[model samples]
Target: MKRLLRAVPIAAAASLAMPAHAQFAKPEDAYKYRASVMFLQSQHMGRINGQLKSDKPDLALVAENAAILDVVNKLSFTAFPEGSDMLANSRAKPEVWSQAAKFKQYADRLNVDVGRLLAASKGGDLAATREAFQATAKVCKACHDDFRRD
Candidate 1:
């Protein structure tokens, strides 16, 4: 009885901690979650861009946004479950599911580029940060070109 009770709570906690992709009850929910995460990523990217364009860039602000982007980047890819791309507002292309390996490659590259951006920002190297930021943007553009619809 005691062991069963302990196992029950452990299972419940594990269920509660399920990945976002599995927690979605419907395609729409996944689409909404993906859209929200993308919006966050865009917003932070814009903030970092604005700072970069400034006469004197704020490395601290860029680092902060980069950190947020790292987390948001991870969330964005997980929300794109198989059926979510069928939604009316979804920009994801069929290739996202059909070419899953290629899509995953882009996702993995984005994570790596974003990590570099974060590291550069935190290191307070403006030149390196700019280069890393451009690389990150390139990955994003490449992924969108291949996987997103018009």
Candidate 2:
């Protein structure tokens, strides 16, 4: 009888601790994750833009180049899995969920562009890298135009 009572309260407490079907453990965690992704995006975009404007463009020379790639790789590998914090980001347009196919297309195109830029980065092939960077920028802009709000 005592064990049953203890178990009952434990179960009740556990149930109360978490909401049913809750995607994020905490709202702040969602915010943190979103901020992290935003930081990575800004860094990546800024480096490419600066590289484009430089007389001798080279992504490899950027301080955040390797770090950006590290985050980018992480972003690529971490599956949002529909209900992850990234999916809950307010900056993430509803179209990300509603039009997943098109979103994925943009994502794939961005991947190819990023890959090309990285591959061409080491040999001072700034022009070629800039072309890829420009394509990636277009992909970002296109998606934001269609999916994100100001």
Which candidate number maximizes TM-score? 1
For each candidate in the order shown, give its overall lDDT on alpha carbons: 0.79, 0.56
**Top of the candidates by lDDT:** 1
Candidate 2 runs further than 4 Å off: 1-24, 62-67, 70-89
Structural similarity to truth (TM-score) of each candidate = 0.85, 0.65
Predicted structure 1: lDDT:
0.79
| Model 1 root-mean-square deviation | 7.8
Which pairs clash in model 1?
Answer: none
Candidate 2 total steric clashes: 0
